[model samples]
Target: MLKYKLVSRANPRKRNEKQFYAQLTGVQTIKRCDFLSLLEKRSSMSSADVKSFLDALEFELMHRLANGISIRLGDLGSFRATIRSVGAVNKKDYDQRKYIKGVNVRFRPSAKWMREKSKTGELISFETVGKA
Candidate 1:
């Protein structure tokens, strides 16, 4: 049976709107727990710790991008700053001069994720009740 069906069976009235929304949004909402509780759950660390780690990683990537460096996250893709020259046209001789003042950015994903995503074929569609 589908996961949603199981959930609906367990709660016929579906009183948990928050849980339903979280499921639809594809985001997990973990409850707050102590370090010992996390260890007991075999998670290695608390949810707060995991969130902090992700924030730190994002900050580091932003810093690298600011310094004009490309960051490649494994299984993700590649990010890099692209520098291009914009030319200025002179009305007198119609001569064009190129000026360079590049922009910094970041790229991630290492091709493996793309291959995996391609294997999924096409996406399934669903209908929304009140939307035409």
Candidate 2:
């Protein structure tokens, strides 16, 4: 389970007001090989086969993203290509090389992972790993 600790912080708008918030703690990184092994255990394919498939998936995903295509991975959500750039006053004055800073990939989580609450307090949906 994901672990977290309660941290007390003063409210930005009110210095005297303070509240406790859950903060992630003791986080650990799972390496590629470990991740492949976990996948291998869940599926019939071996870790090497899983790695090969993932490599191909990465290549194809990058190619499609580079071509300005957005991809949706079901419950995991969608990924799209994005660019960071400075605004130009006019189209004629805009220079792609100068105005465009860089290209980046953006990921949006699925609705299942998002928190939802109704005004009437009728329904609320969320996921919690519990406090640390």
Candidate 3:
């Protein structure tokens, strides 16, 4: 379940006009150690083993992404490095310092994640927790 609060936000175009919207409130974050411990219990491997594997996986992902490779991680998702830059008229006129801003990783959720249904409503449900 997700907890949300009603927030009054002003419109960017019209600052005087405001409307209420649901904003995510107090989302809990699971740290690396805590997540590793949970994974350790679910698998036969120890926490240290899981941590080592995760470290190696991170390295591999970074290396592959830097080399313009998109990786599909089973049912979880696929990740690819995307360029956030300005357009250039010609390839020869394109300059990395001016045209290329930065690179960002993009994740596309799997079909299972996109279209999961449960007996109780949806896979994820939200609850209102008053105004913000």
Look at candidate 3 and give me any clashing residue pairs: none
Q: What is the C-alpha RMSD of each candidate to the true structure, in Å?
A: 13.9, 5.8, 3.1
Candidate with maximal lDDT: 3
lDDT of 3 by residue, 40-109 (tens): 9999998889999989999999999999999999877899999999999999999999998999999998
Q: In each prediction, how many residue pairs overlap at the backbone (N, C-alpha, C within less than 3 A)?
A: 10, 0, 0
Residues 1-132, model 2: lDDT tens digits? 446677789988899999877787677999988888898999999778999998998998999999999998876789999999999999999999999999999999777545332333335322345553
State each model's CA lDDT, in order. Answer: 0.54, 0.82, 0.89
- The TM-score of predicted model 2 comes to 0.68
In angstroms, give how far residue 23 of model 3 lies from its true place: 2.7
Q: What is the TM-score of each candidate against the true structure?
A: 0.43, 0.68, 0.77
Candidate 3 residue 101 C-alpha distance from true site, Å: 1.3
Worst lDDT 10-window in candidate 2: 117-126
Off by over 4 Å in 3: 8-20, 88-92, 117-122
Please write out the lDDT profile of model 1 over residues 1-132, one tens digit for every residue: 111111222333664532322123233556544543564567676666666766688799778877777887776687877666665575464333436556646455566665565445332233233211
Between prediction 2 and prediction 3, the one with superior lDDT is: 3
Q: State the TM-score for model 1.
A: 0.43
